[model samples]
Target chain A: MSDTTDLPAPSLDVEGWTCPAPLRDRPRVVMGHGGGGALSAELVQQIFAPSYGGEALSQMGDAAVLSLGGARLAFSTDSYVVRPLFFPGGSIGDLAVNGTVNDLAMSGARAAYLSCGFILEEGVELDTVTRVAEALGAAARTAGVEVATGDTKVVEAGHGDGIYLNTAGIGVVPAGVDLRPQRVVPGDVVIVSGAIGVHGVAIMSVREGLEFGVEIESDCAALGGLVEAMLAVTPDLHVLRDPTRGGLAASLNEIAAASGAGVVIRERDVPVPPAVANACAILGLDPMYIANEGKLVAFVPREHADAVLAAMRAHPLGTDAAIIGEAVDSHPGMLVARTGLGGTRVVDLPLGEQLPRIC
Target chain B: MSDTTDLPAPSLDVEGWTCPAPLRDRPRVVMGHGGGGALSAELVQQIFAPSYGGEALSQMGDAAVLSLGGARLAFSTDSYVVRPLFFPGGSIGDLAVNGTVNDLAMSGARAAYLSCGFILEEGVELDTVTRVAEALGAAARTAGVEVATGDTKVVEAGHGDGIYLNTAGIGVVPAGVDLRPQRVVPGDVVIVSGAIGVHGVAIMSVREGLEFGVEIESDCAALGGLVEAMLAVTPDLHVLRDPTRGGLAASLNEIAAASGAGVVIRERDVPVPPAVANACAILGLDPMYIANEGKLVAFVPREHADAVLAAMRAHPLGTDAAIIGEAVDSHPGMLVARTGLGGTRVVDLPLGEQLPRIC
Candidate 1:
């Protein structure tokens, strides 16, 4: 008689039988699956998109713009799992509010209400919870949105970290405003709201106990007002992105791939703070792949580039706005940066983030 | 001079300095804070309500009803942290979709779109994630709602359980259909759809490894269709509640307190399946306090109760629907149950759930 028990269980041989187009080589979820990079996109496209089987989710915008009851609505959700709940300039509470708000703003919508879901760990101090709650309330007020509804759940002490918050927001899209990657044209001008890599460096400084001479605080703020200011210049803006998890490079790559266009930026023109650059050099990380919370990358019509930049500069949140790139007819679905030494280099989408939990 | 190093830090004196009305005696969050009972209500009223500072949240309904761009919208959110991601008859995926759908239905709205947020623990099997996603997609299709947008984040292996899902739904409330606690009045009949205690019992069976003669599956389902049938009988439903987390007892106590009315139910009229009853009896748990995911407790006008009951009976989800109680003018803000032995007893809101992570 054959020894059946000695053989591998049928379920254990999942790789041998199951189709692996979506999951590819990995049979287990890794940090990269949530890092908003190539793996993240693959997971969404192969698994989530096919499973959902809906046009709305397939749009893959920062927020889904939908028409309901004759109203144009923007809906989005984001979960905050950043370690060290309290950072230099903000906390998870602020990100919980601002992150979703910025997502709606990316679709040219004015966020109106937010739904907060909190998962708390058992035995976490009440004062700690209160502090986080207070910060969230303050951030919502500052963003001009209401925390209208909420749900709370708790897990056993070891089963959860101190707190993980998920915020889903709803907003109203203006009558004539439409922002999507497909709107990009070859002559479009690309503008960035401010310096990159500050938020990521600030987080690393705290988590790794590495400090430069100057204090680097997170650039965490709601960008609804900044977007409104840009829209005031002209609602004909092509696209907008918050450049979060996978940073500027991921945003550019996604836009290029979605729109089937080429994105070119001048490396000398891309603003990077001295402290952030020093920190990245020491850590052997690229600033292009570091995350940012309170910044936006916009593709606008060439005719309105200067006017939009001027308006963004007038807004308090966008004082550092700069036009650093333009869409190109060549190299479709690719991002290229012109080095300071006058050489062109492809800036590919990151395979994973340099640091996890930098959001 | 006495050594000052032994003195306690001022921050440690949270009990002595901070106003204690909201937090009351507890210095840290307990499992009860997420139990959907007295502690949950206290957390909302004292902490979340004040922090939010808005009237929409004060309604304390299953969903927040709001007017956006001349369209009446109902928005609600819930986080599912049930242990053992998969259970009999349902999984967290099913609950993630149906729970939010039912919340909107309670407000007389037809859910249109849902936002799903997933916090996955790193190293979880890809097949497991795929199964959960497939279940979520199937449930959304069955509920006739679209999963429009989603966000995913991963925590380190030990920092989380297998998976935690949060779903937020948006729906449009039909015109002239206004449901709220204040609309409830004396002589209003309370009706319960199907049986209670099945879901909780099923979870306990797996967790405790206790086997009954018959398998008791969770009563988890989407109630939008059953609710639509009920509304055809009368557009004016005083209030509706899904008996989840804290079960029928908690739902009744909340309605009684919110509407400032007395609730009286005949214990024999409350439906409890034999298998569930047997499991609960062996486990020393009360059927009234056990959770039911696929059931609802609704208060309707007595004049329309018979028609509503008929409508409910014709639907697949409400086959066992029955009128179990009525609101009374005397003993406001209390729930009283008449036992089978011809005695009345006060059914107070549970301090916490009889079982944690029941939903």
Candidate 2:
């Protein structure tokens, strides 16, 4: 793991083990379980077991563990609160699942089970809740995992911000997995997971006032498969990072600081569809620092960059994957991007409020 | 554990357990760890070990198991938020630790370690935060457990309802432990850990508009010792319950319903300090349903009732402990109280609201 990567490829065999218990067909989530009493046990016993993926996890115990086979595990948690509930690509439920799973992948580990805690507003439609949860189950299945166990609490309308989803993930980083920002050497190459600003632009277009009529759907999808492809080909990945809230620029700057290395990104090498670029221009927003729900940045050793990118772009999820920059020792702990005209500037964390609650 | 009769007994041994790594002097919690990142590791490294108790708990794993030599385990999570942060006799910090410990104790489990999560509003006074945290540490020490690994997140101001505290506990109920509601037999006796309503009234007195001066203070202290005392005297205790939110009345109703039995209470046998009664009268509040942060209600076998009560009263923390009622098959699933006037009526879970979030 190095400073410039967001999604790293690491080998892991999470198979064979399975949870035999099945999910009960409860009409909907009842208040009893959330009340911290008996009903909660039934939910855990029935619904939780089927989706949990393993007997160890289905034990209804407090936490989870991964048999990393003597590997260091990467763990991460993210809470999703994307408004408009339903979106072009997915809902908050699915997003929550993929987002945390992707985070662990970025750490060069095989993502396993996740703990989901949902804070739902009291009046949310039961159908809507079921749909979102089903979406989560579907996404978890697609990524070869399970919903496992969860906690659902409904707050009196105002106290809750509609729906808040907290997802914590555990991934096993294999024995030979070496990932860190500090691995970003002077000549390391940077690769973009796909089109950089599509996800962010798509979100902005749906905002109350920034209504855009174009087909700008968020590129939100689980990246574990794509990462698996890359790892199958190369395990010596540098740093993998999801360019979430602060986007590409923030991601780059953080990597630089973390690795104590300098980063040089070429604006020309970055891929941005005309519609996304145009939308960013119209909205006066920098695509580099916008939030991207389904994207990650990776810094890899230069010699293996082409092979890694080729492995990535072969997957449908990474058709637009491309090399964006290289890591250097100069400007240590900072990032300098060469604009279209070769002009360089620094990218930093947001100075003030930039669409608060975007995450 | 039974509905209210099974009082917890502390383990006499504390040897041959896995010790955790040394603690770090982490000054403040960083954001990345809360992101489910490596920073979270730093937190676990620096803060968890020293304060953490129990071999199974110190591994910093998801959940721990007790050798109990085969004791059934009871787990519970509680979040504490008391305005003014500190009240007379106890602070939210102490209350947070004690509250869950008691819940686990009530379930007949000898509490081992606690996992605490703090949601700190940004820009909170450093001194205040540290003090509150230190108080938590000190109390855990007194209770003979480690704080264990904890998660801390600094939400932007106003996002929090003050410094919120969530503590999840792990305890082992000895092999023969069977404290479930069903054990509330017809002649079982009910014993309280101490006086009730004192905690709720103390908070009210400190709050604005309900201002009244008296020597009344919170009775918020861990009841593990007292539980152990009673449990040692009588292992046949049937049920153990903490009368928290909705207070004694709500707790009684819940127990009655859970055990599919009825409970009869004698008003004269209940213990209520004169000051708490006066404050409730002045505020037009009912002392019966007011919360008690530190007390518990225990139901013991008739043969052991006197011995358990004597043992409870012998502990300083349970000086006011008293036998207040008897469980019965009559009035199935209801709580009937014989008032001072010799009349009995139903006491049930409030139809709607009854002092929300008292703990």
Candidate 3:
């Protein structure tokens, strides 16, 4: 009846879907799956981990800690697709560099070399690519890493938006430093490097044409130096996370799940820049759930918390560092906030990030 | 005149163009630039190397050889944008794995780990994505490498064509087995692992709806094991190359340019399958310019040539291997082909590949 003989048969066996079949629900990829939230985590754990089974994957860290020829190395990769290639304070180039560098730094590793892959659309200007390259080179200099090997591929117009960058970094983790979420304990103090929600707001302003009188620059910078400074004070730092997509709320929830520990933070003590707060108010956005680029959250032993804070404050990138929370023994695998009005509320990880591709 | 008061100034300083300014006349990217030809080389040497300057980049090879903690490592990356997603015998996933693994293998390195970065379109089917992941996992297992770390990004609809995959690999180069184009000498013999033009013809057949009675499978297999097989016979292999994108003609030209020597290949001796020859005749395509994935071209000393060829022919993947040419001292930095008609023709690198996205 439908000329079925002319049509081809289906390729895949849809009846046998098992990995994350029930949890994901959607048969098509949604924007939120790339938002770095519960969907992102589920996609990673259920789909990717099961497909690519390896011992190193069992340990969930910012970068894979690999033993190669009697040396410890950290390898991590991140893709940058932030719209409006150039934002207020940084462009996609610097974001690509800082993002991968921050990932390696989260493992207390000093990034040494990086590999960059570029996917460009046809008709993209050569001058724009050159400018992006210049920005990338400058950022690599600041991060103390070399862009060693790279690849470039182009798609026909309409298949891409200007360019997308993927940077994979290799770094050496110092011998004494052993950092992971599993090391978090009940007596650990929670510290944030600086104010949250600046990077996301900066991108939103330009893309949405919502200027807030004063220009909001992205807090995009390499945190390798700041991380090294903290490690100098103590190599026993328990956990380090960069609140990029889904912001600090997602980071806290991830740590709680990974470490199987309870986390409680004081809302008033969390630093939110005045401009960011105003932007969030206008956007009806919660600052805690917005993304950050250069900031980091650290969980350290209570005994070394004061010293770590002092060391972080001494660094230029961490001048606004503040201790806002602590790991708790009760209510394991949960995160809560002490509200400004003397109330407590659960801060659960969203099914998906409020904003997508903030990085 | 045009209500331009609210518009901001352009960001990049186009007036300050320096690297290969006059040579690369085009200000916009064309498909040919990514065709693995002279334009691609010019883009990398002029634009990327100058921006990301380092001593390591001065040595151009399939991969960058780095010394870290007294261990020699080979690092390389490749991006796949092949259309149709799936072909006769291989998909983009296997191409992604085998391509990077081959790059490391060309450097006489055994690939150990890989990092995959996927850029997915917003509405891409999850089933398609799952199938790709499964193919990738299967390929990694076959290559004896692990997909250690990965990143995924989703773009809005109309901004992407299904998906693009980028893989960066790390491998350990065995001691005393140095491989580089500069090491090629006048007396070296040129040996190709198998027949040429199968991969390009396979992809073209599907894209153009050409039927040769029988489906031509893509020769997309990992070459790390093949390289190891050759190394077992002799560690003195001078140079190795996989003729992907630009084919054997491009590879010969590049080797000549890098070694500053002349190459002479016999047309009759170069193995071309009958089906590929027929397809080329129908399409008016040069078999020499077509791409290959699994085949490799090796330059070995005259004394060790027989042993290496024997080893290659003994392997299942290289049963059709043959010695097609030899390096010559005349006409340095040029490639000459001896035709079946008993005449010689100059083989220069094309401005771009005859077929784009054949990989």
Candidate 4:
């Protein structure tokens, strides 16, 4: 376990951000704000939701649930700007599919269709584009969804990365399944679907040119099947989240804020594969704040926790699923973790991501 | 009318395209390739469609129509990369809402909800973003649609332009309205909603720093309400298309190709506001190939042409709408225009966009 005294302050100004603070407190967007942390939350609440005002925008779920005609549907969109298009086990294409699918799945929706929008940089190899498309198609097939529609735009060279992909997904939420962060309650069991931090570490390994002497492939797989398995156990799941940008700590913090509940977890109970642990130790990073593409953290009522965990473990994507913590009445909207040495330390949302574009 | 002797060959390689012609003809994407012209069609049919194949993608309509549960829904997406985020009558915000709304409207769907994904540069002014968002909210209210969900991503300053917005829309396709390109018949009449060239001229006036004495504001208004008005006139509206990138000529050519029919139009009958005509004449740009954000071309049965024209004219957006052309069997999958001097000329899609990033 990481030493509590040696830990840096949770809040720190992000480096390499050159935007002028135009607003009173902060005028420009910082990398931490996009890291799905407190800054990101403030951005959405203060800017996006107020500007794009609607009942749905205020819902603040992974996907917005809406009723069209008499049927309920989940709609979501995400833009992927990961630096290296291809990493150890996945590419931007896989992330595009899995990210949106997981989002819809988190809402207890069956991801049925998706739209792929590609912004290709001029002079990119046709072969490279075809490869990414193939990966996208394969990932969509794996997730049991179809690429229903698409648009393409090209930018001048040097104006864009090699390629950026935006995917908008539509899924059907089953009747009687209502999942939202506010549904989380004190005494709800918090479960991690599998080993965390694999996805972020994998990207960093390739980007930073570090060799951990062991290949740490990205856990960038679709979690729809695992989510479906859990739903099969019960539609009463309180909350579900895929820790992507700001990692497990951010997701837990968001839920705590949304539900007005406190969360306490055992540091050792969170599953971190040996490779990820070694990488984090060497890099002086915390696995709790590292992103994970394929993993999910579920908040379930204690009574249903056992059944859900069994169902998740039975699925291929959740072999390492573990119950890491439980919601508490104390310290509402705060998160604390018990260290391996039996010391309790506050686990705050990182001001910004330790790694940028780790998605 | 352009002199026949002065017309350049339509098949020449686009200048500044650096890729070698290894896969069929064009190897790299030219500006015109994204212009919704023949090049855009090839990119979709040969590249995107083949790569991301599915039943819905093969439909190739303005939006993908899918039956989710018992409700039929129209889904569409578009990315706005229009330079100079703020323009005369509209900004990227207005374009983002209206463009996707228009896409859904073209399919005879009343746009209900939209998803916005913004890729912002790090150093862009917060005030600029807030202004754009306000414009977007206002436009959505005008169109009777809600911005339900949104995503924001910040890229490093040099890697991106100030901002690019992508909106994906969902609308419920009403029963009994079947609108698609393939539904156009040989005797169909082509009706354009409002005057041509205003939008393109408006963008160019600001971008190129030119003025034509009179201000040319973009016709960047949502066409959904106008479409609903037409649908009330008749549920059997044949085909609808917003002439955006690549403009009217590209749209007519695409409809021709899709329906396997020929189109013939009276060049003088097509309405071009005097300001736009003068601007185009000075810029040496064919008004036919310039972009429009708030205009649409409809293919309707000749028998209903008069009634449809009346309905379109009654709507505020279509007050200047005019019947520009007709479908014919003379030259299958081709477009021709009759000059006032009694000469007929083939109208070819531009090899590349004359203006890049003009929405």
Candidate 5:
């Protein structure tokens, strides 16, 4: 774990958070606080976790697995604030449904129902709201989950972006399926499903009005089916994570830190689409640090690696899945990439998002 | 249902909503769409309901009751955008927790877990966020529920109010309890747990800088315990509703319409705090149209009315509980209130909120 010896002493009192000096000397909330990076992790660890102390919250998983009335349930929530309501492959509507579904899927659950909350800007066209809602309804149908309950609130025109949607989902975890970062061991195999950086690059292209030879659309699709295929191979998979905000690099760092295991990946084996690679190269962005909405990184036991890879490849969403690396005993809690040029370099968890609201 | 003879024909083969001409010539969402009144209902029936098209959603209860994994569950969501964040006796944080809890309680369920999503404006004080988190934590504890999972997103400073919170709650329904508006019968007795209009007046006083003779603190408390006590008396109660947003009038109208029953309430028997009544008189607002956070309106069988009121009064949050009305066979699908001067007046749902952002 990163050293906290230089940090101020934490004061656990009932009043409020008065200890653990403000992150990076910034006492006010910055955009990075929502970037799903180091700043986001710090905010949870220092403020939220301490205030809302519980074993479930402390687990720090994509979704909280709870035993309720003899049922193993997975619950997750996400808010979509991506600017420009519609993107190339999907809108905030798709993300609102599929994002929460993927979070539960990462916990080895199939989502049953979702609750949607809409915060609309007053004077927004009724037509725009209709399009988003229709998209949301269609996405839920595709993911096999129902949008069962909802709330709508409108803010005066200037107080909000056109639309912000929050979806909280509930799912049932099949018996004998257990997933958590702590289960990762030194010999664990790391695999990624499909390409990275396409989503972030696509958002950038549209937001900045850049022409990159060929059009790139977000690889945004629900990953529940892919996850189910992998689980069908073996229920003993160590961990599964959807690399959305901080991308594959962030997910790897989180797993390494939580399990106290080092991760080493072969740079040449990591998948990157040609269009995304070209756009990132021109923009000076690292594909590893970019976001992917419909992709996942998995840590599986070495024994089940080949079989799981075969299962993933048979699935449509995972045709390009590949085994890129493995966990190691050296440099616990750190990630190192074996470069294609026969050298190695450390891949640190991003401090903040290189592309904000890409999801 | 209100006559739809003059409404435009609905086209189900939709690219988008092409039916029911805009509400009263309005082509865009207005403040009334969030006011929990006629406009809010129209938005749901015309747009959200048709787009979503699910049985649970069509039930239109405070929470959706579902059966998942052989267990009965109540799921609900609400977004809080109250201005000033802090109000008398509570803040947006308290409502974020208690509001969803009460929604579940209205479904006769004890909330087990809640998922919170925060939309923060960039540049907001960390201290402010801390205080809100603390309040949320404390409120969850008071209600005996866990804040299990959460997500946060940020927008530039101008794009959002200080902080908007959306909470989705999951609760387990007791074995034999069934509560819905459709169950109300002509002879059902109407009872309210406590005084009305205090919450709306308290918010208005602070928001408008009006000094009433006495300080009216919001009656904002979790109603799970109160609900449990009432259920202990009889799980056969016809319906339960928290008079929030459009308040008692809106709730009564909904029940009347859903069950095809008429309601007649005695104004003298309706418990209204003197301060709240005086404030409403001066503000020219009707107590029936004002909101209450900690109170509930219940339609009980005439035979069990006395027992339920006694059980409610025995609980701390229900000391002022009173039987103020009854369902009647006359004037089906309408609400009529008897004034103290022996005159009857029809109480219609407010077109919009008299006080917006009052939570």
Candidate 6:
């Protein structure tokens, strides 16, 4: 009974729980942390921890809760803000669902659920909201995911875009599989799933009023099934990335940066459909830096490359799979493309915004 | 040995999973579901659950996560776009943190974590972003929470106010304590932590060009500490709410709606600092509906009312505590104010946005 009074002597309990040191180290924010390196980890450790910390958050895994009963799950979130909501081939709605599902698929996950948050301008017509939401629902159905949990907020007519969406998705990744960026190796063959510049050209055509009588709509579609098909055929697939915001060049550069290796591609082997190459030539937008929504770049061991390509080609989602390049030990940290005329040029991360909000 | 070979295959293995059944029960976008009744429950069942099915999400609890852990945590989110970014006592920054933290604290959860999303105008100043971020940090530090995860995106200059903040926060709610709007009962004593209208008047003064030349500021601060202190003395505290946005009017009305009971207030017992009252009068704003930031209106059991009041008064954060109202069984779903002249008027919910975006 006497010990029961010891139950937390209030002030003593507070002192015991209070942070041992003053919080001077935890400055609320500094932009340096967004850089993909050391400072980011420190920021997550100090700031994100104490506030949102709990058992679930403590694991610090790429995708938490591994090896669960029966089903394996993968969850991820992404926010898209394409300046021109309506592009030649698609709208922001199509891009949002596709982008989210693709993220889940990259982890070898079958997308199952999505939650959408929409911020709308006060004067946005109910019809327009209806159209966008309809498109989003259709895209989710096509991607085989359900749109769950939605919230809507209206701002003064001028305070926001007609609409902006942030979507979070959850999916199931199978057992006996692991897909990570660090898996790329020296002899891995890189594959480009399809034409790249079409999506970018479609947006540019609409944005800058560049006319292409033959409409090349933005090629936006969820790639989960395609990825799953490829993974089922070859789980050894090393890296998976969809060049969306930043095109092929940017994706390659990011991979090179991550793997600390060099990448070189034969210009002729890469499958840039004639129409897209012609459009890139006319718009002066490099085909390599042009975005693609319905495509993915993968690296697999050479022994399994043809099987993966055959497997990709067999699937309706991946008809034009091409082995475009291979990871090399030389010319580290750079991307070089061999010309059809036997000339070579270096490709690096674009120094400026190539196409702002071309999601 | 094996039942494995003898077991029949499950129906949803792979091929069957590809075919989708056309779901027909849910509305495309109906207004009735938002009506807060039977339809809403159906919307939750047919549409929400099939997609978002999970233990916690399925609970359909008042606030999410019926049980996060033994460590009490409060989680809430709100968006602010008061026409003006800067007002007298506070700015969007002050309202953002205080509003979310107070909501978490309302549930006896000590405000702990905050996530901020900024939608900035394209041409908005770098300095403005820095200042707002700094103000947000200051407010969080003062509230004893951390700014955890954040996202930033710039829209076309005209697409947004100079700044708009959407804050989602999480806090800890202790064991052996429970507080909800439904906890209000007849004979319960209502307590107003301080003079109302500081925040509301501050915004109105700036927005309407009223010369309260005396420079009145908003009483915006995290109320978790004061609430903890008060709750320490009276764990039976009934209802706790920060009368923001819709002001005391909205807050009380919400409690009435939640409790299915009536509320009556003595006008004389309600304290409004002269400046705020004058500002409200000059601006044609009702003090009852004018928001207060640093202030909160609470209800406590009659037996422990004095202890709660003394505890509140002892905290510098809550110096002007007062008994302003009580719960009543008559006139369910009604809020009435006893006029200084002994008359009564229904305190109705705001028909529409007040001080639009006044947070």
Candidate 1 chain A: worst 10 consecutive residues by lDDT? A11-20
lDDT of 1 by residue, B135-156 (tens): 9999999999999999988787
What docking grade does candidate 5 earn?
acceptable
Q: Give every collision pair in model 4.
A: A21-A27, A22-A27, A23-A27, A32-A352, B32-B352, B32-B353
| Clashing residue pairs in candidate 3 (N, C-alpha, C atoms within 3 angstroms) | none
Among all windows of 10 consecutive residues in model 5 chain A, the one with the lowest summed lDDT is A9-18
Q: Which 10-residue window in model 1 chain B sums to the lowest lDDT?
A: B9-18
lDDT of 2 by residue, B228-267 (tens): 8877886778888777665788678767877888999998
The order of the candidates by DockQ, greatest first, is: 1, 5, 4, 3, 6, 2
Runs in model 4 deviating more than 4 A are A1-23, B1-26
Weakest lDDT window of 10 consecutive positions for candidate 4 chain A:
A15-24
lDDT, model 3: 0.85
Model 3 chain A: lowest-lDDT 10 consecutive positions = A9-18
lDDT of 5 by residue, B217-318 (tens): 999899999999999999999999999988899899888989999999999999999999899889777888888889999999999999999999999999
Go through the candidates in order and give each one's C-alpha lDDT: 0.87, 0.62, 0.85, 0.84, 0.87, 0.66
The iRMS of model 3 comes to 3.8
Candidate 6 lDDT by residue in tens digits, A162-196: 77776655556776667765677788899988878
| Top-scoring candidate (DockQ) | 1
Q: TM-scores for chain A, candidates in order? A: 0.94, 0.78, 0.93, 0.93, 0.93, 0.80
What docking grade does candidate 2 earn? incorrect
Q: What DockQ values do the models have?
A: 0.50, 0.02, 0.43, 0.44, 0.47, 0.06
RMSD of each: 5.4, 17.3, 5.8, 6.1, 6.5, 15.8
Question: Candidate 4 residues B134-164, lDDT tens each?
Answer: 8999899999999888777767667768788
> Which is superior by DockQ, 1 or 5?
1
lDDT of 2 by residue, A174-266 (tens): 556566676778899999987877766666667644756577887777888887888887888887777765578767876787688889888
